[model samples]
Structures are given as structure tokens and as C-alpha cells.
Target: MLSLRTRGKSGIYYIRGSVSLNRQTIDVKEFSTGTSDKDAASHVMAQYQMQLHNELLFGPTAKVADVTFSPEM
Candidate 1:
């Protein structure tokens, strides 16, 4: 699971969480979303989570296209 939080006084949103694979838990260090907007931060968090999931499922050499986050029209 992943969550978003603001750090320091910059108000920049960060992504932090852990993933469980093969009965082992791996920690995902806090990553800066580089945005102050909550919505944008959520998008970033989703993309990162997806990437982690794919890497765990398909190995690190898996060739996957970049994930983009866009609001539905």
C-alpha cells in the first residue's frame, strides 16, 4: 500500500509504502512527487506503485511502456 504526505515547509507531496512479495516485505523509500497538488501526487503514487508491481511480477528486465496518468475526459 502507498500513501501521500507533505514534508518540511515546502509542502511537496511524497510517496511512501511497502510491498509484499514471496512472503517478504520490501520497503519503498519516500519519493518526492515534486508537486504540491494532491491530485498530481496521487497520480505519481499510482504510477510508482504500478511500476513496482510490474517489476515484481515480470522481473527487472521486463520491457514495459511508461505509465501515464491522465484525468478521464
Candidate 2:
């Protein structure tokens, strides 16, 4: 998976992901924010949302995230 911002004043954003299956590749592309500098939180949230949506829409069954955080990390 890769995410990047567009050049110049476009302020456009792009996201790319690829999965290989059955000796073939399936690619997914999406855009969220325009070419702008995104804070870390926004970028993370964007990726999280995309993954969740893709799972619900394309997978056999959607699984919710069970996230855990620790100070020791």
C-alpha cells in the first residue's frame, strides 16, 4: 500500500494498494484529501477507514478492529 500527495497547487491526495491472488494482481485506488499536507492523525484515520470499508464491501465477512496500546511499545 502507498499513499501520496499530488504536486503543485492541486492539493490532491492518492492512495494505492495491491493484492496478488491466483497468479494475478488486483489493485485498488482511491482519493481522500486534495493535495495538502495532512497531519499524522488524519492520514492514519484515512487509511483505517479505507481498510474497514474495503473489508466490508469486498471480503467474505467484515471484522472490526480490536486495537490495543501499551506504553511499553
Candidate 3:
């Protein structure tokens, strides 16, 4: 499931979620939707979630994400 949260006081929204495949869980990191507006952010986040779903189901044929956030090592 995907969820949105405000980033500090910036008014910007970010997405976070997790998906499971073959009993393996993938934790999607928080990703910026690049918009402060909740409605716009939700739209963008839905697209992203769909992309992820397609890729997982269709074996990488889906479009790749432009931005990926991984914790700095």
C-alpha cells in the first residue's frame, strides 16, 4: 500500500509503500512527488505505484522511475 506525508513544513508531499513478490518484501522508500499540492501529489504517486505494479507483474517491461531514493551509506 502507498501513503503520502508532508515533508517538514515545505508543504511538499512524498510517497512510501511496500510490495511483496514471491514472499519477498520490497520496501519502497519515500519518494518526492515534486508537488506541494496534495491532489497533484496523489496523482503522481498513483502513476508511480502503477508503474511498480506493472514492472513486478510483467517482468521489467514497465517504464523505469526517474528518481529513486536510497539511504546514503
State how far residue 1 of model 1 sits from its true place (Å).
0.7
Arranged by lDDT with the best first, the candidates are 1, 3, 2
Tens-digit lDDT track of model 3 for 9-72: 8788999988666755657899989889999999998887877776677664455544478999
Better of 2 and 3 by lDDT: 3
TM-score of each: 0.76, 0.39, 0.73
Top candidate, metric TM-score: 1
Residue range 1-73, candidate 2, lDDT tens digits: 4445454566655555654434445465754554455675367546656665556465644443434566875
lDDT of 1 at 28: 82
Evaluated against the true structure, the overall lDDT of model 3 is: 0.79
- Ranked by TM-score, the better of candidates 2 and 3 is 3
In candidate 1, what are the lDDT values of residues 16-67, reduced to their tens digit? 8887668656588899999999999999999888777767777756434554
Model 2, CA-based lDDT:
0.54
